[model samples]
Target: MTSLPADDIASPTSTWDLVPATVLSTTETDGPDRPEPRPACEDVRPVIAGHRLIGACADGPRAAQLMFVSDAEGRLARAAEDGSVEPGCTLEELAGDLARSTGRQLHPENPGLRRVLLVRLDAPELPLLAALSGTGFTAVSRHGWSVVVFDGELDYWAVRTGLDETAVVLSSDGATRSFEVLLAGEDPADVTELDSADAVCVLEWGPPWQPAGGLPAGSGRTPAGQFEQDLVRLCAGGTSELQIESVASVFDLDPAETNRLRNYVGGGSTDLVLESVLQLVGLPVLAAKIAEGRREMADLEDARHYEPTAMGPALLRGMTTEPTGDGLMARYQRAVLRRPELLLALAGTEAALGLGLAGAARRGGSGARVLGTLSAALLADAAAESAYWATVRRARRGSARAVPAGLLRRFFGLPEG
Candidate 1:
């Protein structure tokens, strides 16, 4: 596959900071680490179906019965024969063909956003794929889709690298163990031999190497199993080691954590929840605190939660609040919490940028106007994050605090304080 030159790829502002490692990778630390880079296609089943292949590679399943990476060069034709699989049509054309052949356009299959993808066929290395495959089974899923996301996030098994643009993995029904390529909507695809007397071909995408767009809005927010919900149940039904093991397997409990968990269960103490398990494993409570801090700030920002009477007191201000979750907001807060000095630093940085942009804003050029607008936004971010730190500090504690509502109201004028 011909690599897109740096100049050819359109980059968003967020990506500009990345010091890319390869022609395609988003970061300097990333790139194809697998040998026989022979490009990513030929590394896998060469000549898939009847078309020539390149930069394709496969890994055993992580979440599914048999999983493989359909890299930018890999997405499958799910062929009957194993020679180069070629895409010969758009997704609309192929879907239309299937509609004609099957006598109906199959209803859209929503692979609930809790991505069952266990494999990072998109990983930079092949061997690491096997090693890291078992991970993500218990991770918190963000809209970006990874278990590594901060708490209260949508739980997921793996981060999807390029689901829209390629066959990121071969997912079986887990019951049939039979692989089916279900590419929906419209895009370029390769369905080589549906009409052939003796061949099978199914799958397609808009373009190779170019990941055109993201999953449709609100489409990537669902949880896979009731794991999030089951966490609630697991906490309630802490009766047997069997139940413990079952949840652990779903989460792919870390070996050490798993051992400790068994020891915990064996000790005969019940009443475990997701929070308890996280605590048992020594995963930091800081993650939850950070999430709480962000949620608090979001509440403060929302007009619906505003109480004029509570304006003077910090505690009441928080009481009448109902902040919806914003993972991105949480992400920014998490980063600030990790390196708090950066939050302070953001102020000075924004001030400096604001000074620079003010003159440009006065000049009235479109580029300067854009820069001025972004600078003002940056300033707002710096201010919000600075204020956010106070909430986090108030949230900080070794254990839950209570029993001071009246005292705080009388002395501090903030009952919740």
Candidate 2:
């Protein structure tokens, strides 16, 4: 019966931080030396985030669509649509598909990933061990949970989903309560039973875990004393909201109950954009975080170089070829914006590597063998960094936000002064 106060609630994350705002046309309009968005000699991995599914956001979705992923272990994200898992199906791909499933023309103002129904098993098993006393621990039954992600804002739905809340009980008298339980979803038996006052707020039997992500599989899960018996059913779903809830609850209460703790960490309001993006805060910490990412990447590369195993080469190839996740090429591309200076260093490094390989190429034996083998992949790492650097250099020379502007200039290209 009560609605959330209109002005008090804001979204938890903002896309504007990662997405670069479109800039006005620059010197490229007239100059003959206009640089290509990518390098001319495309031999290496390009230093840019190559989106796999472009215009996906530009395309609109139906009023709503449903995506069902399994929670089976080792094969956690099996797509239920065809009962088979796509070996390399990524989260972004899933999001994109769900966004386009209805196949409708999108409104120009509201294009891309409005909402999608995510159905999966829950993630409460791991943290449920803390229950002080409960008689039906072994009697819990499996229940499928579903939720819709609207514009990637997690907290908006958090208050309404009851299943995600946690409780502390002196006995069985207590239960974790959600801020509100507006609807209980559609069930025919209950339709005839509801009173006039109850009918206004009740729609369908809104399963407890929708906006909060799916619920954990209970007693009906794998039996005790078996190999898979001990495993807790997890719903680390593909959507941003599900992933955010699951990841944030690593050390605390049942992943379901971790909301209040998260709110505390976010200072009563958790917004990824406010904390990580906007220039209102000091970013010495942000700078360190970007540096840490670079360091971790360096460490992985070092491990691959010295591991002396056949797997190292395969791992390196995966890193370079995979465009998303922790891929090496992805890191290189992201570094282009976060640390453009690294692009200059990488250009020199690649230049030397090309020279070393040049002599090897002329040998025409082992050199040819290398080229015929993994040379394209090998050169891609170099090309990615070098090519991106070229654009940054061109922009700097043209006085594109080259002067003291804002802290963001350190991380992105700004407009002309």
Candidate 3:
């Protein structure tokens, strides 16, 4: 690879206010023992599949996998032993391809997200560094990915020379591993096959790093799996660990909280759903308060059973109310509750599905048909709130009276308007 001027690489404009390191060794008396560089451990060899290097490694209790793609290689690899050439990829084309696989963790056979990656490229390191840095990666060393996985912390040299990307070790599905690249000082002339893993390539962003365009309006008629994919894509957009984890599994949430949100959503107002999800994932104290409030609401529901007249004042005020397991609300609320992080998107989806199911139930649609229709809707992009409320507007039945949005918001402690 031609050596690019170091100045070509973009650096952080400001220094991070890092936490002070605890000084030990000969610190106070003799200037701290020059910090030692951590050892490198490249314990695994990842398979080079097309343009991406996919592999897994473990260090004690921590484990991670790597899915590294190079744009130049994807487009230029030979087809067979006779060496028929394949079309090379443009920078944007390659970036989009990589993002689709990486964004949803559905490629290379559902590897899920990993803690680290081991990359080898022959091009200028600037572009790849930028992408990883923007995605919250910290370069721990020059020795390669293995050593950093074992130590879980970078040496002074790695920190000083590398971008100030913060590294967070999250719970991963594979072995604990570190990410290191095989570039920096290697010779391009010594490189053998361009398609081979040893061949180096530079990475640059494409016009679309991931899938493009806004989510479509959801309906029973949506193409199979589109809505579910939208939900998964929403999870990928999250920046915090809590946001990421919460979206990973809806079943991980508390049953009571899901139940409460279910009733409110059934009543045709998903206004507070986003705030509730944020609190559940990022602020436990607030979540506890919400839970406590829900408990009080539950108590009121119990009171309604014994003193229906006594609860009239509260009901007239449009408070958030709980519905029974078999109620119209539960039919979709429980389904959407499983993935609360998507509550915003799902609010409209659940409403649309509920409407279809309601008509189906009245028209004597079979259980299988009702459930199958709902299943399809769940996987498609949810409808907008306006769409959901429109359906509520057309409702003339007494049952719809229980779904007043203002009362529901008040009962759930949501702000007015």
Model 2 spans with C-alpha error above 4 angstroms: 1-339, 371-375, 378-380, 394-417
Please name the candidate that would achieve the greatest lDDT relative to the true structure: 1
lDDT by residue (125-151, candidate 3, tens digit) is: 222332333322222222111111211
- Candidate 3 displacement at residue 298 in angstroms: 30
Ranking, TM-score, top scorer first? 1, 2, 3
Sort order, lDDT high to low? 1, 3, 2
Worst 10-residue lDDT window for candidate 2 reads: 168-177
- In candidate 1, residue 322 scores what lDDT? 20
Error (Å) of candidate 2 at residue 206 is 16
List model 2 lDDT by residue over 1-417, tens digit each: 111122221212111011101111112224577542321112110111121110001000111111222121111122122222222234344334333642222121222112222222111121121121111111111121222222233422332242233310100001111111222332211333212223322111101112111212331222111111211111111123332343333223554345543443333212222223112212212222222122222333221111112432322222222122233323443355456788667656765676667667667985576753444444565675565465555554552211111112332333322
- Total backbone collisions, model 1: 20
How does model 2 fare in lDDT? 0.26
Clash counts per candidate, in order, are: 20, 17, 23
Better of 1 and 3 by TM-score: 1
